[model samples]
Target: AQTVTQSQPEMSVQEAETVTLSCTYDTSENNYYLFWYKQPPSRQMILVIRQEAYKQQNATENRFSVNFQKAAKSFSLKISDSQLGDTAMYFCAFMDLSGTYKYIFGTGTRLKVLA
Candidate 1:
């Protein structure tokens, strides 16, 4: 069984600053994928970034990056140059490629960018 945990329920960041969202998971599977999804008020899950367990380099997409610690089973997201549009509910998710291909997601972390 795999489980994702987001310690902070809510986070606030000043506009133009940077914020990092913590995410930890427990999993026995060796092959899997970790993801950070952003869901705005519209409720659409947008893929922020993803990291494969086998990849040594952390995944990065523009202003979004991930710190993937394979041994510790930790995956955290960093949002740089925060903007008002970045406000949303972020979710940490895990998917085991060797299993049923189901995603176990964290409760969520609500992020707000303040001007």
Candidate 2:
């Protein structure tokens, strides 16, 4: 079984700054995908970034980026120029692409970006 871990239960950042949220996972399978999901107060899980195990280059989307260390089994999300709207509960998720596509998610990190 695979599991994801987020050491930080909660984190805060000032608007217009950068914040990195940490995530680590344990998996025996070699083929899989890692993801960072953001859930705002509205309760919708949005895909923030994704990384394929085979990809050497990390995944990035605008202000969102991920540091994917395959050997270390570490995937962290870096949010640049944080905004008040960026405040949300971030979850690190894992999906085994070869299997039934079940998603295993971390406990979650509640991030608050203050103005």
Candidate 3:
């Protein structure tokens, strides 16, 4: 079984600053995918970023990036130039290729961006 762990229960950042959320996982399978999803107060699960196990290079978005350590099974999200709109509950997710596309998510890390 693959399980994701988020050490931080919550996080806060001043507007325009940067914040990094920590996430680690345990898996026996070598091939799989990792994801970071954001759920705002509206309760919609949105894909923030994704990384493949085979990719040696980390993934980066406009304001989001990931530090993927395949050896340690650690994938963290870094949000730069944060805005108040970025405040949301961040979840770490994992999926395997066993024909079942199910996501095992972390408890969650609520991020509050102070204006």
Among these predictions, the greatest lDDT belongs to 2
**Location of the lowest summed lDDT over 10 successive residues in candidate 1:** 95-104
Q: lDDT for every model?
A: 0.96, 0.97, 0.95
> Which regions of candidate 3 fall more than 4 Å away from where they truly are?
none
Candidate 2 residue-wise lDDT, 1-115, digit = tens: 9999999999999999999999999999899999999999999999999999989999999999999999999999999999999999999999998769999999999999999
- Per-model TM-score on C-alpha atoms: 0.97, 0.98, 0.98
Clash pairs for candidate 3 = none
Query: For model 2, what is the C-alpha lDDT against the true structure?
Result: 0.97
TM-score of 2: 0.98
Superposed by TM-score, candidate 3 places the C-alpha of residue 79 at a distance from the truth, in angstroms, of 0.1
Model 2 off-target regions past 4 Å? Answer: none
